[model samples]
Target: MPPSPRNLDELASALLANGPVKTLPAAPKRIRVRLGGRYVADTTRAVYVWEHAYYPGYYLPLDAFAEGVLSYPGSGGGNGNGDRESGYALATLSAGGVSTDRVIVFTRRGESGSEREDGNVLAGLVRVEFAAVEAWFEEDARIDVHPKDPFKRVDVVFSARPVRVSISGTEVARSEACFHLYETGLPVRFYLPVTAVRADLLRDSAAVTACPYKGEASYYDVVVGGVDGLGEIRLRDVVWYYKNPKIECAAIAGCLCFYNEKVDIELDGKMLERPKALFS
Candidate 1:
């Protein structure tokens, strides 16, 4: 039997895309979990499981956790079937001065409201909620937001393409040197120099966001003055910069990049058409 195509319109492109592969016990990586400056879980044998199409989750063997660190506060009801058939039970992961509640501990429980079923692959494995932990590490480096996709790649290229930016018919920036950031499944971003932008129009914003591959980024709101009898416009967090980007994108540090969807961008002498994306 033939497999159903995921996307009918882009059949050729979809055919070239990466399909799910079965890696027994999943892909290996040294994953460590920390809470309140204390290491609660550390394992060299950890597998990556994709709960969503965007990012993968880490699942470690039950023994990887330190003794007495994971405590089930009781299901409050389950008919006292012991911990084996608890299914997904609430756990209090506490160590040192740190603790978190509502942490799910996946056990040998079945999907239905029943006893532990045999042949369940997740029987002996422990599923830790990534967000519940204070920090995660791959070996020694600290990871942020989420785990890095092993299949994804980010490339930074130095381009001499002359780029100009405008907001509401008001020309804001023009630069001949722009670093092009190309990430998997994302629109190409043109990062411009600070001198190329109009300083008077920029307002420092308190927004900050982190990326597993690119470190933390600070934002700026571009406020354009009234034009052609139109009121002043404020584009919130329309521009962002990385002061200390990760090594892979170190070259683009301190460079500003505007949200192409919120502003008009011109490559060379031609205006670029706004691309439809998640942020758009």
Candidate 2:
């Protein structure tokens, strides 16, 4: 896998190599963000920034942020062209009379020729680290990943094609009632109902990961008999499911999907070649 973009120039190059950036209107939901027991931002108006080859990020208006929370630490220097520049800043969020350094915010100052339909400027916008925050809420329930992009599409379609998953020659799941999830810029993900999977072979795992587009996911370890002189093999956190997916991806709710790179998957009796992606 290629290393992630480290600086403004690399990020710009990556973006140019991929496609154009999109700025879209998001759903009007009350978003309350906190960090280290401090309320960082509370807003009902946030936009989704869909950058090429990257997950959508939330950008709140400057007025939405609490006062005295954002302070400029220093400049992040230029992008080598001398035209584009960036700066680093520290945010101190506070609540209940307690304060903490929430995150290091990065601000960009450049002209990318990208314009929003609403005529709002994208430059010099303050973007917070989604993971650095202690908690994030959409109205009432806490959600994982960043805010789902309203413009991004997620389709979960029922497939009649047979899908099978195996680990070391041991069948783990097979289903005709499989749901195929198609998300933008991602490989096709096959999801099987719990009834079609070998529940006995799956053990709850502590690992949890989030996708800004898919929502929060829980993992399961697959313990199966190994082949080629390897005895019992445990594939840690190989299977995952979203119990409560974001509304846009609700079609895949409660369905299980395995990491294709870590397991053998067959569709319609033909083995699938693992796709090269950010995760691979």
Candidate 3:
């Protein structure tokens, strides 16, 4: 027995897959993809599906076709344009439930353009339905080098800005450094080693956060830098330190954290504005 016509679900699936074949987008429903004053597929009736290389595409039915539009140039006759001979012919079809209005038929090679362009012809070639086209979703996240630095570069400038460090009511350090970034849209965290900071001034805090760009970070309290007292200098979870970042951002493995507004940042002795968030 001959094979049965593809079911609704199977037909829909194939149409979506064929939408973005090698490069072009699946035939759109509402838009006119007229190569010769003929309708191919209606985007409105089709459903978009997923695939590799390209993306999800619009799928249309086969029965609602109007007639010949595509012309297969090559399989046999020596057409002047190599590309022309290899392509197929197609036409638009009217929607009729299972046989949607978006349907179109593609002709096989070795067929005449005049013969194949009309859907009424081509009793031998296979029918591949059109599907609704869908766009691919991209991954976007913030990365901080302080979390991970697999690159192993020293002084990696993920981002640069001014930062203020205060303890006990008085500001202790203010400097401008490139806040290394691990991912993309996170804060430009500065990488300061333990030695650069005064150990006696820091107090343990239980603040922590995870970054897709970086790794994980621990928090600390500014207990003794300024002369006034502990109450005068309080940065709640403002300071962060990356424990073991990737190799590229190795310089700021165990530094401290401070908000730019609280400190005076200077680059080459000139004060600089607070750096914006890595996401911005």
Q: Each prediction's TM-score against the native?
A: 0.81, 0.65, 0.36
Query: Each candidate: what lDDT?
Result: 0.73, 0.67, 0.40
- In model 1, what is the error at residue 201, expressed in angstroms? 1.0
Worst 10 residues of 2 by lDDT: 75-84
Give the C-alpha miss distance for residue 243 in model 1, angstroms.
0.8
Highest-lDDT candidate: 1
lDDT score for residue 175 of model 1: 99
Give the winner by lDDT: 1 or 2.
Answer: 1
> Please, what are the lDDT tens digits per residue for candidate 2 over residues 1-280?
1222345444444433443377665558777777667766888776676654355767665556676655443423322112233332344445556554433333333533223323234433445656656778888877676666565577878899999999888899999868899987678999888888899889999998777667789999999985653788898988999999878678788889998888889999899998887667
Better of 1 and 3 by lDDT: 1
| Number of the predicted model whose TM-score against the real structure is largest | 1
How far is 268's C-alpha from truth in model 2 (Å)? 2.1
lDDT of 1: 0.73
lDDT of 3 by residue, 1-280 (tens): 1122345334434433353233222233332222223343223332333322222333233322234432223323221111223333332222222222232233334553423342222222223333321111111222231112222223456444544454433555554544544334333445544654566656788987754334577877665434567434555655578888545555567766555544444444565555665322
